[model samples]
Structure formats: C-alpha cells, structure tokens
Target: MASLLLPIAAAFLLLRVILSATVIDDLRNLRPPPDFNSTIARNCHHNPSLRYCGNSRPLDEIFKFTIVASHLCNESRNPNCVESFDKIDLRGRPKIAPLYLSFDFFWKFCPLTIRSIDFSNNSLRGEFPTSVLACAQAEAIDFSHNELSGDFPVERLASMVNLTVLNLSYNHFSECKLSESLVFRRFNSSNFVHSGLIPNKQSFAVKAVFLMIGLPVMVILTVGFIAMMCFRRRNLSLETPQLRHHFTTSMLKAATSGFSSENLEEKSDGVDIYRGILRDGTHVRIEIYWSNISTEGMRKFIEECEVLVQLRHKNLVRVFGWCDDQELRAIVTKWTDRESLEMWLIERAPPLKHRLKVLAGVMEGMCYLHKSWPQVGYDLGTSSIILSENLEPLISRFEFDGRNSSAKSKFVYKHKFGVLLLEMITDRGKMGDVEAGKAGFIEHIRTSFTANWQNLLDERIMIASTTMEQARQAIEIGLACIDHSANEQLNMDWIRHILLRIYRASCHVNGSPTHGRFDGDRDKRHKHGP
Candidate 1:
C-alpha cells in the first residue's frame, strides 16, 4: 500500500503540472483539447529549453490568449515540436470575430509556431482579415461559414508552403483567381460554389468562345457596349486567364482517397503514381513528388507547365496541369486503362496495321515536338508509349530542362525516336530486353541489326499479311536514322512522309481501317500497283 501510494502521488503531481498550463486553453474551448505534454512532440533527444518560454502570453485577464501558442516549440530539435498548437480554435464565439484589435495582438506576440487557426461558425462578417496571415508559419486556416466578401488573393496564398488545410467555403468573394500554379490538391469546387470564383480553364475558354461568337452579334446590336467591354477587358488584370486549373495536393488526396494503396499504381523513391478521377468524370494519372523544387526550380517547372499545357497533338498525352506544393509536388495527365504499346507488343503481338499506326503516330508526335519545342527531348522507354482506346499510340513522356541543359537537341530526340521504332519492329524477348553482351539497349540495336538484318523483323510481324514489306521499309529507315556514321542519314521529315506512305499502303492492302479507318478514297496515290 505504501509503494502504490508513492507512485500515485508522483502521478498526481505530474497531472497538476499539466493542468496548471490550461489557462489559455479554457477561453477558446479547444475541441479534442491538445495535450501540452504530448509525448510525440518530445521526439528529440535534447532537453527542451526555456529560451522562448513555455507559457503562452496572456492578452489580459478576461480573454487571456490573444497572441500565439508558441511555448512548446523547439525548432532546433523536433521540426514538428509545435504541432500541439496546430489548431487554435476561437470558434462559436460571435464576439471574437469582429475583434481586429485582437488579430493585431496575435501578430505582435506570435512566435511563428502556429500551424492552424479555426475561427469558423463565429458568424464573422466583412472582408477576410489580412491579419490572418499573422501566423507566419501557418499551415491551416479556416474562415468558412462566414459572410466574408471581396477578392480572394490566391496568388498571395501561394507563398505559404504547407498551407494544405483551408476552407473559405460559404463566402461571398466577388473574385477568386485559380491561375496560380498552386493547385489545392482537392480542387474543392464545392467550397467555392456559391463564392463566385471562376475556375481557370472554363473561365478563359468560355470567355474566349463567348467573345468570338458573341462579340460579332453584340457589335451588330450595340457597338458602343462592345467597345466599352473590350477596353475594360484590356485594362483588367484578371488572373491573366489560364486555360487549365492547377490542382493542389489536398484535392489530389481527396480524389485518390489520401493516395490509398488501392489507388496507388507505382511507388518509387520520392515519387508515386496514382489513378484519380476528376470532378468532370475524367480519368487521370497523378505522378506525385515528381521532383524536388531545387534552386530556381519552381520557376523552371512553371515554365515547363506552361509549355506542356499548350502542346495539343494526337500522339502526345494530355497534361492537365502541375502542383508546386512544398510538401508534395505532382503532375496530372489524362489517363486511360489501356495497356502500353510495349505490353501490346509482348502480350497481344498487335497486328502489322496497328504497329504501323503506332510508328506513324509516334513519329508525327516527335515531329510536332521538334517544331513546337526544339530545345526539349522526348523522354521514354519501350513502356513509355501507351495505346489509346482507338489503338493510337501516345507518347506519354517528355523532358524540357534549361536551354544550356543537355536535353535540348532536336537531332538527339530524332535519334531517340528512331531507336524506339527499331525496338517496336523487333521482339527483343523482353520489354527492356538486352543481348548477352554488356552493350546498352541503343548499342545492342546498332550492332545486332547490322549483323542479321533479314531475321530482324519481329516474328509477330513476319507472319503479318500484306504489311510485311511495308514493315521492312520502316525498319530500313530506322536503321539509317540510328546510323550516325552515315554521311546522309534519314531526317524525321522524310521519315514522316515515308511512314505515312507505308501506313496508307498497308491500310489499302489489308483493307486496314483508317485511324484503325481513313477518309474517302483512301489516298489512292499511296497504294502500290497491283
């Protein structure tokens, strides 16, 4: 009994020590109240110091905590040392909402440790206080269920690195800009439903389409109003008009159910690939943490995003937009459930006609890439080409580094395309198949093809009717492109023309459908003499 009593006494003393620090916690009535002595915050081996003090400063006797909960923070040791104050809930108290003076007090005394602040359901009115940014290290801020109005400075919000938790829903903002590269992972279209925010993609496209069609009609009806509108639009600095809405990491999590294993398709170091469905019922694949935002990296990536969004072609995969969040970075691209071209090659041994179409499409896309972004290189392997529902091959990867960066050569990309064609034409035993030699994929192709050129056509295609000769022609051109030693090598332009001819001939001979069926008369000029 004596031993047990001594242990109980020590426990009681520890409890008293914790409860005494609850002075500020009472005024706000924190929900699921924080544990000041939360063992998790003490992950660091070093002893917590008193340099910044552990007690939150009292504003006054009545409303004691106006400043910040910076006491438990020890940045040098545990980076998450201050998450105990993760959420400062001064909610449900209508009187607290209108106190701009209290907000200023928060700014002056805040030790930059707060991550979340909840002031929802306070019946707060008027503009969102600029002082809310006072929690300089804020991660989550809730201003929902209020009557706030005016512009939502989303561009300004982009500066916050870990600002993942946010809800400005049920507000009356006149304008919300979605043009910034920061895609709130969740899109949260419902959050801004009644808030009068225009999504970037529809906002720009709709306006352009409306202006093009409506302007002529409006001009004929009333020229003066048209002139006024045109002048105003030119002067208005309204979000610069983006054609696609950037998605945030939060929106992605919601779409992918917090990137659950079921939705995760691939997991690599610091990178993850997921399958997601957009609000519009579009299927997409998200590659998360694509790469770290190194020095001047965000700017370069933004440029890449701008460039990628503008590329429109049948052979290239569609990129919706990119996320530049500090915690997680990702790129969103249109996706389908179809197998990649390599899979089609290995498993189904796609027909000669399908193979020809793949080659033609890949070459066409590469040509467009060279013309559109000559400085960039097409990035891919055998598995990089995915066959769409219609059997059209789409090049799913490309990379654009800085101008001085090595990935900036049209010729190099052309050579790469040639190697791809060679790979497609042969059955290399595996997707990334290699010969018994130490020679790399490219080197093996160069030497092997030169040695036994005749048996090179994949056995799958060798038996393919009527298109076999055409397949041979494609192989010849591919060899010439990769043969750098040749004085007169095949350029992509001539290659494109020849492949187009072969595709037409193969279609005519096999009665092969165009696009899997072509237009009227079937380009009879490309047909061979019977």
Candidate 2:
C-alpha cells in the first residue's frame, strides 16, 4: 500500500511541474516586448484588451462595428441605417425621440472617415465636442435645433476651410464673437437664431458698457444723452463738403424720387439696389438695407463700409458714402454704365486683345492691393468685376478682414486670381465649376489642356499663331498660381512681371506700339475717358 501511494505522489509532482512550465510558456508568448516605434502598438502590446486593438476581437470586426454604428439612425421605432462612409444626414428626426449623443459614445463607436455630418433637429444636448473639430476632412456640419450650450468656437471652426456649411441655429449657446473668416461669414442670422452670436463690435461694446455700469437708470440716461449729442453733431457737420459726401436721408429720398419702383435696378437678399443721380448729375448705385435685413446682414453692411473706407484704387469701385439714419440704412457707390463681367462674357465675348488688356488692369490692381495692404484680401470673381464705359475692368466687390489676414490669405488670393485667369481663357460665365471639386481648379485646367487645349480656349476669339505662345505662357502662369503646393504658387511680384510681359508680348504681336509708348497712350485715354 505504501509503495503504491509513493508512486502516485511522484506522478502528481511530475504533472504539476509540466503544468507550471506550460503556463510560463503561454505568458511569455502573450506578452511581447515593447515596440517603441509605434505608440499605439506599444500601448496595445502592454494591454492586450485595449479597444484600439479591437479589445482582443479581430480588426475586421472592429471596422464593421464602426461602419454599422455610424449608419444607425436615431429613430426609436425603425432606425433606417445607411451604408455611406462620407456623409451622414439625420435631419428632421422626431424630437420626441431625440438622439442623445455623448462624446465618448459617438467617438468610440462612429466611423472616423465621415466628411459631412448633418444632425439637425436631433434635440441633442451638451456642449459641442471639440474632439470632432480634429476631423480635418469634415466639410459640412449642421448642428441646428440642438440643445447645445456654451460658446461656439468660431476661430477654431474657421481654421477648417473644408468646413463649408456650418449650421448652429436654435441652440442654447451663449454670447460669442465670430471671426471675420469666410466660414463664419457664410452663415447668416438664421444659422444663429436662438444662439447669442453678436454681429458687430458696436453692439458688443454697448452690451459690455451696460453690463459694466450695471445701473440701469444711469446707463439709460447716459446713452440717451450720447445719442442726442451724436444726432446734433451729425446734423451740424452735414454743412461741410467733406461731411456732405454722406447724403442725408431726405437728399437720398429726393434723389431716388421717394424710392420709386422705376429707380430699383435690382432686388437681392432682401435689399434693393437703386439707380440714383446726385444733384451734380453724377450717377450712383444705392443699396438700401430695409428692416428685413437680419442682424447678420446689418453687420455685413457695416463691414462693407469699413472695408470700402480704407480702399483707394482707380480700379476699385469708389464707395462715396453711407447713410445710417433712424429710418434708412444705405450704401452709395459710383455707378458704371457698362455691364458686369458675367453679363459681358455671356452676351458679348470680347476679342483676345481686349480680354488681355482687362486682365492686365486686374493684375495691376491686385498687385497694388497685395503690396500696399497685405492685410486686405479680395474675393475675385466674375460678378465682382465690372466693365467701365471705356471697357476697362473694375474690381467692384472684395472681401477684407485685417484680423484674419495671414500667409493663407495670400494663397487664397493667388488661387482666386488663377480662377480669374481661367475665366478669361475659357470665357466661362462663372467660376463655380472650377471650385466645385476636390481635384482643384488647376487640376481641371490641366485635364482640359491635356484633352484638347483648343477646346479650353475661348471659341469666340480667333487665336493668331503669332500670340499663341504668349497665351500658352499666360495659361502656364495661371496653372502655377493655382498649384496645390503652396511653395509652388507664384508671388504677387512674379505674377505681375509675367502678366506685364504677356501684355507687352500680346501688344507687340498685334502690331501695337512698344510697351512704354502704348501704356502711356492707354493711361492718357483712360484718364480722359467718358
């Protein structure tokens, strides 16, 4: 009996040693050495259950989960799931069964490849997740009708150029100042109805002053007194010529014949543009902002005034003055008889020589603006370019925001200038097509040039072999300007030199006088023109 027990004990001891060795081998295989090269891999290696590594699940399963989660509709009854990876539109969902999203819940589960997110009318709550801003490829984001609170990060939002359509309306957001970037400017008052988004500095200052004073009675009296003084001073100053540049409400009323329908040239975006003649017989364009103008619109009107006041260029439309009386708010600018560039391009395509001359004038004006005031930027487009009575091109409208001016602004200017050049060569009525896709305007031009350069050229104008080389060079310069790489984009000075060279070459090829003589004659004619 003792001998049998001893044999059994020995067998148990051997089995225990084998099991211990197997467990040790398994642990060694499971725990890999730290991979310092990749932080994610290293983290996953240290903790095998990390979610980034699918929490021990297969990578395919993780990807599938992300895709499925992103498409899951918020509808309580029958959630319609979509399979799209780029855009997610869940607009006008039932408010009673609102989709309540938490930052962790969405970020951890949703697909990261989404480019456009539309969560409008979701009845979502909580502050907007800044983590979502890190999605560099996100283009259009609509968060309207949500119960979102806190300050809207306008500056951060503006940094993303890909983010075009941003809707933040009907939210419980607090007062926040918007940056003068195109992103913020694209949104109107409707995008911020319940949200406390201040429109202008004046309103913000007034609010700040009132808050600081705190004494309602004293603040009211002081504000009233200041307003009275300003009204009196404005009336008194109107007698001077310099001050008289700003037409009175009565004078504008008389000029427009009590805002008659005949005076109305165009009506756009709730504003009426009227053709008015001053007492001196000088024609002017008056843009009257009626009460229907939203707070955002009024802010834009003020911004326009501010930008126009600083600009002083022959090629630019002259802002004579503005009227901001109790009953009327209007902007007055010098009127031109010739049609807009869009109209001219569509109705009557000019000759190549004439187009080159107009383009040269535009480049000169752009060069001046770029050099003299690097802080100011123009939104160059066909509609912004107006033809004068002498058929000279005038940059009638521009965008200027000194606060947000940067190296990127220069690139934007160059890109728009490239679009202008494309417009010239193609004789296209609009630049919309060029700016429509991710391939870029330069890519579109290259594709067209590769397919058939002749087809890309304006068919209305016959090209002579003598100036064909110059046209090709001009196109090359334009293509270079719109290069995807910022380092490749030509500087304003270089662009000017190339444009001037092209103009001179065109002039010489057309049997016109040499550079200096022809320019001098043209300048004289322009200066003395009707």
For model 2, the local distance difference test gives 0.64
TM-score of 1: 0.50
Model 1 accuracy (lDDT, Cα): 0.63
Q: Write the per-residue lDDT of candidate 1 for residues 1-530, one digit (tens) a residue.
A: 01222233334435544877653333334222133233213422244443223435431311222112322222123355432434465556566445532446555444455567677777777777766775667877777788888876665565677676677777787754445424554445555555555455667799998899988887777977788889877866454534344788798988898889999999998889999988888889998875666858887877777778777988889988888777777889998788887788889976676777778778778768777766555675668888887777788886875432232254456566677787878655532555453236556656665576556667877676655578778777776666664313445556766777777787788775554433432343332211
Off by over 4 Å in 2: 1-242, 291-307, 402-405, 427-442, 463-466, 486-489, 514-530
lDDT of each: 0.63, 0.64
Candidates' RMSD to native:
27.3, 35.4
Clashes of each: 14, 0
